[model samples]
Target: MTEPKIAIALYSYEPQEEGELLLLEGDILTVLEEDASGWWSGESNGKTGLFPGSYVEYVDEQLIESLGLEQFEEISEESNNTTEQDLTQQQGGEFSGQNINDENYVSDEENEKDNTSQNQNQQEIIQTQNFTRNIGGTTMIHDGFIWEEKEPVFKVTIGKTVKRKKLRGMKKYTAYLIHSGNFCVTRRYKHFLWLRQRLVERYENVPVPPMPEKQFQGRFGEDFISRRREGLNRFLNRICEHPILRSSQIFHHFLEADEYQDWKMGKRAAEKQNKKEVPFFKSITCAQEVTKDCDDEITEFKKNITSLDKCLKNVENVATDLYLSNYQDLSASYLKFSKAFLKLGSEAKGIVGKNLDIEGKELKERGKEQRKIFIDPLKDYNRLIQVFIETIKVRDQANFQYVSTHAKYTKQNMGELSGQNRDKLLLKQDKSDRMTNITLAEIELFHYNRLRDSKEILTNHLKTQIEYYRKSSERWKKVKEEVEKIPVIHGSKKLEGMEDLSEPELFDEKIETDTEENQTSNQIDKEIEKNDEDNEEEDDEDTDDEDTDEDDDDDQTEETEEIEKEKDENEKNEKEKDEKENNDDFEKI
Candidate 1:
């Protein structure tokens, strides 16, 4: 009698017995006999032995027939004139027999063709299964390329604040995903964080982009919420750009999940599947050693993070303690000064003093505001630095463990270990290699996130500080103008004691001015002598250009003559005016 065939659908953890068929997951076996004890004898890979019937699942012949029929139908549909039999014949004789439920089958020649077609189809299916699995409606094509009719896009908008019972009435930042407008999903920053973490864990080779850091202060602030929403949109766009990462299940779920709980459940199931141990032989690439050079580079990165952390901490300390304390002290001194001005009462007080008091109070408030602004941002930056340092430390530990495990396995496999022992070693090596790659990717991600987050925080902090100081300066400038307008008060002088000067005092002032003019004339003569010496030096330097020098000297002599004539005319006019003024004064006397 012809025996039925079965395939192992899932892995069996049971130990193999002597004279028993050891069925690996996905192994095809031809069933021979079934016993009442739920044991079935089967032939697999040319060996005949008994195995548990529960350990294997029967292959669906009807399903294969249906698939073959669908192929034939597609061919027939493409060609209007093609008959069903003709399409079937063209499909390598896959549907040569009667219907699957029929009592009579095809002839031996057709059966032979059908067997050949089935074998070919099975081979093709096995070869393509690993690389071409349809994940989240995304078709993975050859060479790990994901093919889609329309590339998915995220049109993210910050929606109204959501209040959930689980969130304890605290408003949550809600992001609405109008995914190409075909479907929509509502997610929070936390959901996105969860998706990102899963993607990083599952896809070791793919480079996942960084997400925006969580803002504690402005958790529900409008601008912060809008920024985070846009950031998430950009992040999704980046994921779509990568072929492998785009087809990832978590990414798909993030875009398509209608309910948060459903997405969570799906994520959990996917994570569980991801944890399944893949066969060592299936992952041959893992046997390859991660080079020592990578370890050295990671070590260097760790050192850089350590240095950066120290520098950031110092900056944070300065912002909080040193600079903040200085501002506070200045504010207190201003307050004291304002109090002293108030104590002077009406004697020293004016509108200017009141304005100064107001300014001092404003300055104190500003100092406190600045302290909060500077210290709060620095605290955020310090936290990011700490996270970066910790990530690197964890990565280093993982790397060390992986390298040690890999080296030990490599030694054991290379030595006098048996076949099974070598297999075990190789498996251990593969696991270690995977761990190393995971940790390495994490380190890279941490580094990227650190740079992204720190840059943003520092930039915003500086902008805020600049804006604060600019406004403060404008306010202080108005106060300074008010202070400048205050008139100076003289202690002893009275307005009634002042009087106009007499003629003798006015004449003495004129005589003093004449003596000062004579002294100025003596100084001008000395300056002219210095100039003449400088001209002589210039003449010595320009001895070869005697014609040009002669022309310059002639010009200088003409200008000097003109200046002397003008000076004589001015002296004559001044003497005439002085004589007229003296005659008028004599007539008045």
Candidate 2:
């Protein structure tokens, strides 16, 4: 098992493991004691306990050497001031020890033999006290300065006092220089571990040494140290240049708006926990996630809706009228339209997935492309129709001008003819008197000829104009018909009725009545003809009876008596027949 790199402060320290716990931001602590398990020895309050080795990272040997040298220098500086009483006090009680506070520390008269030395030492102590009490209007301390708010950090055993610079801007400024104010300066600390992690992230395939002690010596040298310092400086620069910090604190509200909003939202959510419905725009991106404008999502949804509408309209336009009338394959078409709508809606939803309000190139390009493909066509079609209508109007105006000019010219030239011709022209011009005059026919003849020629020219021009107008009108009519049939995407009727008429059965009653009347009239005419034929048949039968009566009398016997009576009747019938025949012959002749 790897040894712990730093010492950990426990209630007790014992010998169970070999590891070190970090202290003072960059201090490496060695395990004084260890056992078979993964526990390391650490000391606190004169008691030792087995601490876990895994809790510590081993420091490099070179760092330990440098620290020892620094320790030596500090030991020399305090050699004169070191007291057995001070040591005793540190070992006793709760051991509130780090740098000795004046409240708990003093010197014996024997130890203060040099009065000048004593004065210099007292002055130095006073100066150190003042510096530690306040640094740039903020409480700061040197090494081992323990405070209730701050953790105990081991001070440098020996170092020159750093000059206090203004640091500009604010009277009270706390520089975030040290990683942890209370921790020891050690090679194998969490801060160093973070630095190592950053290095690994930046440079792939970085060779890490198995033994942190050896590895630290090899890698974290002057160059790495320089890079780390540079990185730290850059981080500080970013904080200094931060908009909130650079500008007036009046803008602090805006900087804290997000946090304030989140807190407010959280309170609202807690208050209304029982209410299931969330208000629109209430649900927001969490603080950890980036937020974006809601308008983008709305626009994207609109585009998708438009696209689906277009697909539906195109399907309608392309579909055959006969097929639409009978509605064949309607199920498939409906499914297709539904699928398209759903897919487009899904795409629109995803367009702002996660960070819906964030701006990016992909979103911009998507919006642009959607407008071009879906919006431009309808606009172009509308513009073309408008232009077509205007063109037709212009053509009509031109035709009107040509007709008016021709009429005016025809009227004006007829007035230039000679007197007799002029008189004749005047007669012809008058609709009421054109045929009345044949006087001075020669002048009239010339004028009439000219008028005829002019009339022919005018007629031809009018005919051509009329034909052109008809063609243009027909063209426009067809176009308008097509456009009307084309489905209007939004707010248009879903199911269109037949173009022929809304109700085809409206004329059914009239048609039925007409059919019935025609049938009745034909039947009556046939009946009348049949009646005439029946009358003629009756007349023929009477004539035949009369002829038979003359031949049957004597041949009848008793039956002949009956026949003879019949023959008497027949004789009368035959006389009537002969009279009728004579009348028919006369009529024929």
Candidate 3:
């Protein structure tokens, strides 16, 4: 039997069965067998499953070879040019390519040779253009330093919960980046922590911004997750602003690498490169200075932790004393009241009394449960705060040792007379510096990790608080429903005189009805008045229009009369002229 070949996944596959593997896009998988159907059996991320064969493709050897050839040619050409230039300089004569008076010295044969060389160069240029077109104008360059200016765009989306081996189901956040190409990486809060740690380790001088606080209580809450997504966006934007860090190989791999193993390897390589063994003496002074600078921040952090501890304790005390204690007291009182009601000897009253007794007992039990819910989470929170404080104390102690050793080393270096004494002081300083560096690193790691844990503890406590209230509300709802179910028992009391109560109730109802009737009548009258006003306004407008129409009709009649008079005058004038012309013609004849 031959070993199965490996193939790269072109698209992500979410398996439907437990045995099936979850394959991310760009993941390398071992192909075991092929089925008659399009599905092929493959193993990825240590899980074997059937995947669609079309979703993956084998790595192409030709493409890899072409990429290598392009890089080799570029390097070879540069080296050849440098060698030619060097040889020309070593000969101590004018370079052959230097310009000269061609008319005075050059022959026809030399001119022909130059023209042929020029034609050859043009042909090479034309060939290069054709080659570029053949390759879709996108060249694959192998030089690691070759970088293009591309603005990275980040988008985050909350994905489905995924169950992993030996761990609780985790919610996935898929981060998509648009840079040279569209790249997507799915991660959780822990992955964010890992990235932050690496950034801090690699870029010591750069102030790495904090991530969204881990929330255990609302770890899956929509609003919290949204805020976290926004925070992640800001974090990436900050990372992009740094010149050196933005161009980092690891950073690029983190954004663009499709294969998880390849990305991890790149990160590991970056970390190794960043790791440096410091001279003990030099690092001791630096550590002391760092401790001094961080004093205020550390103190502030401690104060916050203390304040949080106190707040948690106060909440626990309130829940225990005010709520639980009150519930217990109320339960006892209700129990005594139930006994009194049972002694009344009415069946309905007895049932109500029994229900009240049950309610009291239930309330008491709920109080205990609520107390546990509040106190248990608080205890864990307090413990976490205590741990944080202790860690800070240890950090302070380490700083004290660094400062003390640094002072001693400085004193010895300043006053030492003998060579041996000076050497010993130097050795001590080196040891001190090494210890200081280690301690400082530890302190920083502790500080960040402690804050992260504190946030988780607080989140858990808040979740517990929410659960307590929810359960309490449910219990109260049940109590209310049960109380409503109990039948009321009638008794001979002064307040229960139906005839007297009926008169007042009937009077009140009659008054209410009368008031409503009056209101309706008033509203109707107002509407009628408004309508009358509107009608009057319309009538006035109509009257105005009638008057204007009459005036217009009178004006038209006058104009017609004037026009008829003018026509009559013109006709009379024409008849007179005709008569006169007839008389003149008769005289001429």
**Top-lDDT structure, candidate number:** 1
Model 2, C-alpha of 392: deviation from truth (Å): 72
In candidate 3, what are the lDDT values of residues 457-497, reduced to their tens digit? 56765786577568656766766776678566677354221
What ranges in model 3 sit over 4 Å off? 1-292, 337-354, 415-589
Model 1 misplaced regions, further than 4 Å = 1-127, 130-289, 322-418, 441-453, 486-589
Candidate 1 lDDT over 1-589, as tens digits, reads 4366544322222234678765544455678887665567888668788876655555556554766644533322222111112222221111223122122223468765755565555545434333322233222222111122235533443445453444665644455544534667777677778887877566543446667677778566655665555556656765665544665666777777788788778877767655442321122122223455445666787787678768877887776665545554554455444434433334333333445445545554555454444555555445545644554554455445534554565465554433333333333333444444444544555565566656876676688678866876786687677667756777846543122333334212112224433343333334334433433533444564886889999999999999999999999999999999999999999
Candidate scoring better on lDDT of 2 and 3: 3
TM-score head-to-head 2 vs 3, winner:
3
Number of clashing residue pairs, candidate 3: 4
Task: Order the candidates by lDDT, highest first.
Answer: 1, 3, 2
RMSD of each: 25.3, 47.9, 37.8
Separate clash counts for every candidate:
0, 45, 4
lDDT of each: 0.51, 0.32, 0.49
Q: Global CA lDDT of candidate 3, please? A: 0.49
> Candidate 3, after superposition: displacement of residue 556 in Å?
99
